[model samples]
Target: MFKRSTLSLGGTALCGALLASGCANHLQQRSEHEERVERKLLDHTLQVDIGEPKSLELPQRRIRIHEQKTFEVTEFEVTRNYDRYTPYQPWRELYEVPLGAVAIVAGVGANILNVFMLGHLPDSVTKDWIDNGVAGINPFMNIQSHGRAQQNLASIDEVQRDRRTESTSLPWSERPVEVQAGTQSYTLTTDRSGVLRLSLLDSPFAEQDLSHVMRLRISVEDDQDNVRSDISLPISGSLRGKLLEAHALIYDDLEDDDVSQWVHRVKRLSELGLEEEASELEQSLIELTHNDPELQKQFLKSLTRDAGRLVADPQASN
Candidate 1:
């Protein structure tokens, strides 16, 4: 009986020991599982350095880097979505006509008008005179009237004969005509109109070869009537050479005596071969003439005559 009791007590003690050991093993496994879960969560948290960890008891939100050295929390529920905006096309709204319709219509209208009005009417008409005459009045009549209006002209032969007769009768001093012949000189009379008669002279050259002298009468006319006249008889051969030399001397004398430096420069430039430069100088001379009218007029007339003589005598270019 004693043995059996001892056995029972031992059995009871063993069962209790076994149960306690199992309970301790189970508790140790549960503690190890919790530690592993905690380590995993801590590892994830350690991956990011969100400054000093503060006790921010707010809602969980995603943070993004906004700019340099800055972070912003964006809550999904708080942000609003907007529709994308697009601009309207202007080409469709601005253009009214179909591509080239305006140009086509204008060209067709012009062709129709041209076909209807050929040579009957004037090509253009002002708005003020649109209804003054018939639309297709004959334009040929306008041309015919213009031609008929230019039929009358002055009698040139009678005028020349009268001018010649008047020029031969005047005194020598009042109508002074100078002829320079190789250092020798001769004087002649002029008409009432200051024109010198060339044909009336009974010279040795005139009897033999009349063509030696080119009789040029320069007349200043006011409204188709002669107001003033000057005759230039350019002699041929050695006489022409002497006259040209005398003209050159006269030009040089005037230039040397002139007080204005501008005139001196202009005269000097005219002697040069610069036509464009001389023309510009002439324009300046014209302006100067406005201040001294008579002097300017005389200078211009002399310069013009000199230029005319230079043009007529091709040998003068050499």
Candidate 2:
């Protein structure tokens, strides 16, 4: 009975040990699998969030003016009819004159007498009658007002117009990289698994506030150290989940000075036979000047001139 009990106890211990070992192995395998999946995602994915373009409202104001006035005149005529009264002169009655002629003579005599009386009238009375006509004296001299309708337009924050909305893809993890937009530039690198990363030096957005959306063009170097074609794209959150991502290195508003510097840089790059770099700069120039036809034309002219010089003097450039 004692041997059987010992045997049963040993069997139970063996079974428990096997179960514990199996559980540990399973956990290790699961951990390894999870790590592999994570590495794979990092190698294959690149994510980005481009920012929206900034803008501002323009200035506006309202003003109004009003005026109202009225005037009137009246005239009175006084007449004495000689026909209504018998002539005071009895001798004049001796001649039977036409009644109409007598009335006309009386009117003429009355008008002449009134004019003589007016000439003798005081200067103030005569001036009052001449100046005022039938209406009361003029109520206003020259109307003068110093006050003006006033308004103030608020100062508006300048908007960024040269920025554009663009989207594209890049094999960022495959090589060393360069990206340029406006005056900003970014350098990139990748891990062994091809996960892309930005370099701190000459990075446009390193210290700037990152936008969820950004405009950029990506360039990469292959194994041969040759730059590949540029990839233009917007780095934005709308894209479905991805393991890797890149962004523009700019946050502040782009200015004319920045564009001028970019132009100078493009010319310098072209002069040295760096065609890929110059091409990247040209693409950025086109984007910046896209909305202004004249500016675009001027930039293209500069590019053409520099390109011609480069082609004509390759050895000199070298």
Candidate 3:
């Protein structure tokens, strides 16, 4: 009898051990997709686009960077089985259920009235109530929201477990970028829009001649190295030459020059496609020859159409 009891007890113990081992194996099992995701590397980069106007000096200089950091990201999404009505407020649903029933009745009556009135009433009047009633009946939209579920968008923290290699965009906004041009280095900050507007005259590049440099290098600092580390922005030889000439004109003694010389400078800037600078110089000329309408008019008149009609329309010279 004792031997039989011992054998029975041992068999039960062995069965229990087997069950535990099976459970452990099931828990540890991973799908092939999960394995692939774990091994996958999400592509990330700071993409720079040379946009319109092509002037490095103006704000229209479209050096826009689409910065998306989506590499090796361990995604942690707080998830659980939620009903389709998860977005609806709890207390609101209680009243909404009955209100929906009433609204449905009202909609039916409105449609009936529309039929009786021989389509005198607008379709929207009946349709709006019907739609509203259906939504309320569907138990999806809540009438009033205290915004409890909306808070999910406001914050994210580790919950449950971390999911690896999920593709998502990490915003590259308001980041300080370092640009190096020849011997000069400037620290420029990107706006919230991720656009780097290089104020050529405002920055150190103004003092340093850009005509000599082949390309300027901009480095994304302090962040992930997996992204585009160094971006080489090419400086066109023609633009560089124009900038050099523009710089010389800027520093030149415009005040010392007589009317003809000033007119030549204005026309030169316009020819160089420096319309903004030309407009500014025209303003200075206006101030210089203050109250002399005839002088101002004559000066503008002497200018060819290529000089721009900032003051008045000028006849173009062949």
* Candidate whose TM-score is highest: 3
**Candidate 3: clashing pairs of residues:** none
Clashes of each: 1, 20, 0
Superposed by TM-score, candidate 3 places the C-alpha of residue 116 at a distance from the truth, in angstroms, of 61
Q: What stretches of model 2 exceed 4 Å from their correct place?
A: 1-193, 197-254, 258-262, 271-276, 307-318
lDDT, residue 7, candidate 1: 100
**Residue 148, model 2, lDDT:** 19
lDDT of 3 by residue, 134-220 (tens): 656654455322333332222323343455555554334688788898878888888888778775544467788777887678787
TM-score of 3: 0.47
Candidate order, TM-score descending: 3, 2, 1
- RMSD in angstroms, candidate 3? 19.0
Candidate 2 vs 3: which has more TM-score: 3
Worst 10 residues of 3 by lDDT: 23-32
Q: What TM-score against the true fold does each predicted structure earn?
A: 0.16, 0.21, 0.47
In order of lDDT, best first, we have 3, 2, 1
By lDDT, the best candidate is: 3
In model 3, the number of clashes is 0
